[model samples]
Target chain A: MSVDVHLAFPPLARIGDPLERVSTPALILDLDAFDANVGAMAAMAKKAGVALRPHAKAHKSSAISQRQLEAGAVGICCQKLTEVYPFVRAGIRNVHISNEFVGADKVAMAIELARHITLSICVDHVQQVRDIGAAADAAGVTIAVLPEVDIGQGRCGVASEEQLAALADAIAAHPGLRFGGLQAYHGGIQHVAEWDQRRVAAARSADKAAAYVRFLEARGLPCPVVTGGGTGTVEFDAASGVFTELQPGSYIFLDGHYGSSEWLGGFRPRHGLFIASTVMSTAKPGMAVCDVGLKGVAVDSGLPRVHGAAAADLRYTAANDEHGILHLVDAQQPDRLGERLLLIPGHCDPTCNLHDQFVCVRDGVVEALWAIDARGLSQ
Target chain B: MSVDVHLAFPPLARIGDPLERVSTPALILDLDAFDANVGAMAAMAKKAGVALRPHAKAHKSSAISQRQLEAGAVGICCQKLTEVYPFVRAGIRNVHISNEFVGADKVAMAIELARHITLSICVDHVQQVRDIGAAADAAGVTIAVLPEVDIGQGRCGVASEEQLAALADAIAAHPGLRFGGLQAYHGGIQHVAEWDQRRVAAARSADKAAAYVRFLEARGLPCPVVTGGGTGTVEFDAASGVFTELQPGSYIFLDGHYGSSEWLGGFRPRHGLFIASTVMSTAKPGMAVCDVGLKGVAVDSGLPRVHGAAAADLRYTAANDEHGILHLVDAQQPDRLGERLLLIPGHCDPTCNLHDQFVCVRDGVVEALWAIDARGLSQ
Candidate 1:
């Protein structure tokens, strides 16, 4: 079913002076690393002969998506329909919403957006497909609908081949819905501590998804695409010959959690993202205060790690609303009051969501700033 | 000292349609209840015979601060100087930055801002005070400087009266800086879980702060303002006769953590904030999927608690970037797909920071939506 689009008017402007104007606790993007990260991901996908569908949820900026497309990405994957609008509003042609939408209002919004963009959305249930079909019918549009299959995360998607086939048949039966393929993403393996375990999990996940595709082929149902794979397991999935497109997002902005993972295989791409913060206070001997805290970086993946400060053996500990506590691990103190400290956030995605702009710097000079245009416009 | 005025541009136009919008991971504010909360706090301060300096770190909205000022708040206390900009830009004249700012850029920015508003900022170090004085001099502004004393939180601020007095003396010695008052905020007591212990901790904190105030009085230093207290200990500090003004931010948007805590003395203030999320999948028996996950609500105070849906014994357990896992504890089979659930975030401040708009509803109907205009404007 064609997805309806909601227009957030004034179309988000590219943040001009994101770093200079955004106050403390705002998200800052390093332009140099961000460009390199995007280029490297595209190059990796191209080398593997796989399609690159960069996930918009990582940065949620239409400008960034445009840049990705210019760099030869096939399409962009959106987490939500509401998140798809800014991209479509920016005239993005191909979009895939990698989640399910059930409500009439939400489906209607998606279908509306589909009018201007090549839209596809994932559905795990037949009821959701019927709803999407009805919405697409009302909107006078035919939409590509993919039945998501659960590999391991067990969040959405059909649990088995039988359920997946049934959902695909239901979508095929619907008038306005066209069977797109399958969304097979293993979210649980993203942070697997060991590389071998992560590869095994990815292979197992791909095997499950491949079984569904084989079933669809036997039934003669058109399954044109198979999309999935995040940054953590994208390479593994690409090499497994199961995924048609790779959606590795955080490769563009390597977070502390990703950079310091125990997975010692091929996951350590590079240090691609860093938050520039200032030492606000130094009242205690063993602790220093920073401007970034819970408001700056998400700690769900764990606390941010200190970066580029050679003198201090400091670790980011407790965080209040505005201030971050840096616990001194070694005797060397942190930069005194007024010194700028670069921080590697625990999680890149949510940390990117916290900032309105990213201050891109390279080789000790500010290059550019990217506005996380869709920073908090979650539906 | 004249402050540099930073005028905020008019708010972005209402981006999306309100009525047809599906409610999921949406911030909902009850305007009527919010006004009542402001009035209730004002009345509480009046009864205690202390001025109310409502903290802006919670709402971070000038619209809310205007109501606080109209009700009875003498001023607004911002956690940081950057937080002061939005309010100052909105023309909320009196602002006290409770957090310490010790950078060349930040101090200069503070002094620049002091040029247009009645600005006061906290200082934790003698060197910080000196820097502030120098910045004020450069900006040609005489700024009110408050010495911050650590009562218990051990984050930022002077640990003892001697340090506090010395910082005050340092500020007083500078021509551009005026020793305005003392800032003694104990952040640890704000979420103490239990009632009696929280009260005791708060009382101890107040006692320690009062002793410092008395010491300052003995030293012949005029302490014009003794501001400190949060939603958890506003009453204790007000009754302790130490603080001339109470600064409570989260009271306006009462969160689940505060509601779960017994420390606030068993009174349900009926505050405005809530997060509305939608059920995405119910594939697993006794477990439901929601759109509001780690990205929707801040989980630091603990996971968001289910509210308004009695049928589902729902509790947010695990959250991903785009999904929330609701573990149903009581219902035999809870939460059908597409169900709307109202959630009380574990922490309201950071949760609010995650949204771009507050879908204000009254009587079960979405009435007005306001942009969290400065949601991620934090630099």
Candidate 2:
């Protein structure tokens, strides 16, 4: 009884429609801005002699992932195992999961997916290696296993070289598992909001990860790759000269959280993603109610900003689950009912998760409608 | 390229499976607690002589809506037109939208939905009324139009009595529209925290809405049905003697926001809804990482709380888009990888929107599987 069977209508806009005519709560992607971001990030990785592997969790669209691959990405990064199937089935080759695979069920799925395409998963524990190796051997497929090392994020990854050495040995002992290098990502440093803070964090991360490369080499196991970086600090990670690969996700659809941060040091890509909403009510004097709110976008990073050159003083201050309160801060007149307004989401990752498809637009015409082919596939 | 074509897998559990075997990031609904909540709220409204209309936007599942209807709920309260189709198609006779309909697309959908069953929508302006009336006239169905008044929550709704009268007049003037009294919802008061603060806000709301009823009566437009109240202040609203019906959405699955609020006065229901996640990473000494994160649950209210008899001191503190950080505050040993954990989401409404289905469990076994059929139909 899923609404997908009946929700054939209520789409915000059709192809070849102008921005003002699109329906509210539609995920609109400006191709002009999106292409620039893709090119810039790809070029940055290439100039530093690093293989670019864009994270598909940011967009969740196979078409977007294909575009990134066409732009010289060595592979696509799946945040989890369930997310890998859609991209692989949609013809994306060489999928690398940037996160961990814990249980037997997930390990079995990874082995099954590896039989079709080149599959790689991150691991920081000996048990995970044993579980994945058992499944991969049973399926007769070699799954690349990257041992994660804690650089600075403190969220995940192995904290010490001893643990990394243990995980690598466990992988080497398994027949169907190949030893991939370190997955050292300092996710917290990606949003430091200051240039020096980010640079310092990246230097620390690079030094720690490079030390792991040396540690593994001293034990007769040379680390082949070091994969980690994001939109906020990809430049620093690339310039670190120790990393062999980069995984930057959000650069294709720069959002308010990243746009407002100045830590990237002059690499301000254009904001491409927007949630188009219509003003539903203007009865409360200076405040107007829009259709999209907490359900439409992610607010953990921050509130959505009003997207317009003329809407400088207009603000989206508060939100209920489905309604956003738009305040006419310095305006002389309130926005009329049914007026369409574009909103720049606070964070692109979860905001993209809320959508089923992306209305890809160039100028005022719809170029193509891309399905978020991996939406809701987070395992 | 839609994931729907490939996402036929990854559903957490089937019927009769124990909770321990369910997949990670699954929406788990405890039917026992859910049924108790439904009965409690229904009895509370029955004692106050108020008709109970549970909001479907909370769970977004037609199965739960059917249960509410079977339990003596006066139909269901939908927040938008796209939300109405599923309930009406599923044979729920009456559906009332708690928000306003401004555009032509929504008005047309409302009119179409009205042709099949009873459809009532809220309006604060004459334009909404006129548009609905014209469409209803074309479709040959009378749509019940409820005029919204600003009842402390300064978002949406008309502010003055004169505006309410004007909207009533507009509804009466059209052959396709009918006046259905007032929608006076004081939303801000629901999360006021303190009992006295919520009580004061409810009193103010009741007083203002009662004054409007008298004003409308003196002007020859007698108010009939008054609907507005939520999980936190439903009792206060019921005792006010001004409302004929109550609309509370989140009472069935009490969330972290409502559970922590003392405004409910010791009436803490068992948390019915949970995000069942897997402990993916335990590399750190005292911190555990789960697969559920910002995309898995809403954090506008607060972070999730660990659920289980043994997890008294385990707290879910920080979150990225796809990772929840579980801190072992009191326990010396960290949670092992691949262990299942239940997370009571901060806010139930937006958290329900994240997943496509619900795993209905009872007595440690899955009783049934329900689709979040109305998920993402927020347009």
Candidate 3:
């Protein structure tokens, strides 16, 4: 089966090959920009005196996670249970599932993973704690639990102090479970566009999380860690004085959506990720069709932006399953068939999950092929 | 590396197991509904005196294609070069690449595939014809070439008779190439919503294709085939008298986007595909979160709809990377924790690409596990 996969989707390029040798519709990673982004985030976290646990949900590559760890990241945060396997298999000692999950299969996976490494998971319900805790107890392993509190995202987190306290008590009641911290991630506020508005929103989220922390403290419960923040709010979150750790994923590969936002100051991310596509057809006047589309890149946010100097001449107007319609700004400057173009995806997380491997390039030459180990590990 | 993939994403359930045994966020295929859908489309094409060539880009499964072939499909259509690998490997004799592709790598793949099977591909430019024709000649293999004419889709097809003639002549110039037919697909007209509007759009597309066929006939060119149609326009195209073959993919797995359209009906398709997700979080008052999200389903068409009776009471409001937020219509009827819900995806093609395999179920029991062999074969 593995051989079948490799044969069907062979490596687009060999190491040290020229950029033109790489196949179209392949994920391209600029190593210099990536390293700079990684180092910048690490430096910002160190200066702010907070732990940097870069989320693996963005890149989904164990090799990229290793690089993050080497640059002084404390650990990594995965949004799903199965996403942790690749990192753990690569000898990572710490992992935190930063989302809530329930079911026998999930509980079994949690218990199995806890035996090999320091495993932590988030919960917003008492039943979730019991589900994993009982399985862990039966397996004779301890697991860390973090109760997630809603900080404005309003998706999957506890809404009230009563619910939060009950979840903490539920964790304390289990011998195999320990109260790790609080997850107060507000995913909605991450793309607020305006600098002032985003800053204010991040502050409100931080205040709400601080209030939850105070409630826990007043009830004589230990709140050892307070983890939150993302790429858009990392600067304010690191200085918020409430969050003990930062979980920023997309900072390493700033996409077109993030690029739309105004960045005023510290730790500006670079565009390290791109989808290299080819102009397959120029059949219509002033319009060219590229090979990358919904299957190659995620279009949930919007259509991708043509990168480099061509951005002034070409615009990606629409996407079908396997065809991206590119309209020329100047009809005279038509895109030639087989000409390559780098596309900056509208979203980074889901876009990374669409590919099997990333063609890491340095100085316009292929450097490595990093497998997206957890590409389809949504289970 | 393949073992790593299997370990990280194990089979959700074994054959003959209860549906509850399947893991959350799994692609589910109702075998009964799927079989009915296959039979319906095949019967429709047969009654209309048109050959059926079901597109494999929707399901990406060799097993599904095999079933289509058994149901009387003349051949299968793949939208990409790499996507043809699984069907070819599964002993499929006839395969047509229904989209135009360019590049030396693509030419090489085409020549390699033509050497083993009766391969046919679409082209809109003389350069694309020369590229594949030269490669096929060197390999001493005869390949069928179809020139795609723009029938209002404005994506990847020749817009003028001169360009179409050029492509046809270019194919005839090479001993290894044969002018098989004309391709006139209007993908944009597939989802016109209203019955009359869609009918008119389909008629216009048919008329345009008929004009192209007449043009070819006037020049003494034998247009043996004229293929183009999707699930939404299949009913009209089968009786249009212009197309000799029909290519409808999503009819086997009618999604929310296609379900929203009005069908006056020659053949009504059933919803055979679903994403089985568990309500993992119910901490928020009137809302719940499921495991299937942006990574599990495609949202470019729209958000998925909750399947079955609960759909009237629960709405899938939004999708995060790993969570689908569901809002309850009646606050009293909250979704229970660990409860499974079926989700009809917004789109079928990209949604199928997100999963590795489908859990085929019949009467609430798993019947088989069919691999999505060409899931990410966008190359």
Candidate 4:
């Protein structure tokens, strides 16, 4: 729905203003915390001798992607071909679709995108590779093809080493398609809850990646690169010799789900992302409602925690489409209507997709405004 | 995030095209079904002597709102003040915000909008009334204020008639505001599953609303209108004389959750809304993935059901951010990549909010494209 520019409330606050002045249900990015997380991630990847190919799907902001690239990220990983346009348009090169591209239309889209910048995509089935190769050939563009192996996330990707070899053969046969090693990652393993469980899961996933690499190399098709690791598994993945690159999207904007995991063992990253919400209605003494809900943030991971409200026990118990229900967890601290509260989203990815722009605040002052450039580009 | 006109992909199809030609992850509105649903709702409400104030929060499309108004329905209800702008901008005079408005900025915005359109809003606290009254006074506008009483949904509403009377008195104290009616809705009761349960819930909710009316009237504070009913409870609500107006937004779009309920036993509304997704990856015969997931459609209530694939047992098993996993339930029917499949969302309201535009189709051909004019205006 298009709105008149005058009526639309884009930036919640002006530059050099405090966070309290920002409007309700606005996405807030703590720049100081964000930069620190970025630096930490960059340093970890550099020491591990692995390129940090940050997933743009996390922030979906080209501004954040620019900063990541500036901080030694090899490239940005995109989930959809349409998502690549924003980051690549902002002058970032080496765009990789970590997910599979299906159908002729979407493959053609990927082929078209390859014309502008260096593009790579994952594939499990040979038919998908054939379609991609044909499109790339038609468009006179070369696309690096990564055959994704199922590293235990029972979703997409090939199950065996033989299937991986077959996909590699399919890619080599096509003139326009180049074989670009393995795309292996256990998506569900990132949020295993238990630290020990995550470590075991990450180690097992790396073992699978290593097995895929060894099998491909012995079969005379030397795997050029092995890319796969999320925020939770990146450190464990670094110890494994197979992976040359890591894809950690949520490291910059840590969420409640990640905060639960002991994956960030020693490095306690600050909460970089928050939903700035104002109490809209106080119907009773013990209850209050905020102007942020299922539409403003996400609830798939779980209900978000009230950020920085240490004095009060204010838990986000429930959410409707446009309202978040808050209960007085601690009767000592009372909530006043119109007072602002910061929320840590249950999941950072989908929450970012819900908003159009992100307010960058630093030292209690609105530093900048960043557009979530690839907000709904899930084509 | 705003994109260049050339790069935007909001509309998946043009006019005079087949359903199969429409883009994947596109919102589809079967016009024949939509018109039939609208006619059915209007006829039912007309016979019941209760006006149908269709909730705009469901469709969020001015086109659909216009069609509903033309079908003998009263003005629609919105969830937010900013959401009211697009509907009003399209020439809808009466805009009722079913949800509470908070903060000075939002109430001021509502007051400004009241200058052009007849505005009605709900309030659960005295502070909310004070805020609205102040803004309306400054703007020189009269706002119809409804005191919200919680019948069942423990979100944002007054607990008792005494509290509601206090709010009404506060509204009467302000010259800029007028006492509208009682905002009583047991939101979750509408989807109780069993026919008897919904009837009981609806009757109880209506009883509470009737009690509020009597209490207010006894105190010399008359309620002009009593409005609250969703798709599931409208029939029972019609039996109650208290509700002068019914707000059934999702009735036009039959979803999986509603379809499972026995409430609509007599009248099985046609499935109006659909997620027209193409089978992206048929990596294996048993498993196929579609290009629709959390970002494309919501998965809060449950995963969406596959439509028109009865011969094949295709269950939408799981979802990634941009993909839907489908498994062959019957194990007999084969799914091919690029084959189009229609999906009935679990919940219609949030699903409608995810998409920017709805593709209107009639007789297997594209008819018109309608913008979801109030989508993402949850400020």
Best by TM-score: 3
Top candidate when judged by DockQ against the true structure: 3
DockQ per candidate, 2 decimals: 0.32, 0.49, 0.54, 0.44
Q: Per-residue lDDT for A219 in model 1?
A: 92
**What tens digits encode model 3's per-residue C-alpha lDDT throughout A101-122?**
8888888888877877788899
CA lDDT for candidate 4: 0.83
Tell me the spans in candidate 2 whose CA falls farther than 4 Å from its real position.
Answer: A1-10, A263-268, B1-10, B263-268
- Deviating ranges (above 4 Å) for candidate 4: A1-11, A264-268, A330-335, B1-11, B264-267, B330-335
Counted clashes in each candidate structure: 25, 1, 0, 0
Each candidate's fnat, in order? 0.42, 0.56, 0.67, 0.44
Every candidate's lDDT? 0.77, 0.85, 0.91, 0.83
lDDT per residue as tens, model 1, A218-257: 8997567889998888778888888888887887877877
Interface RMSD of 1: 14.8
Better of 2 and 4 by lDDT: 2
Let me know the DockQ for model 2.
Answer: 0.49
Return whichever of 3 and 4 wins on TM-score. Answer: 3
The stretch of ten residues in a row with the least summed lDDT in candidate 3 chain A is A1-10
For model 3, state the Cα shift of residue B133 in Å: 2.0
Indicate the residue-level lDDT of B20 in model 2: 80
Interface RMSD of each: 14.8, 5.1, 5.4, 5.4
> Distance from true position, residue B245, model 2, in Å?
1.1
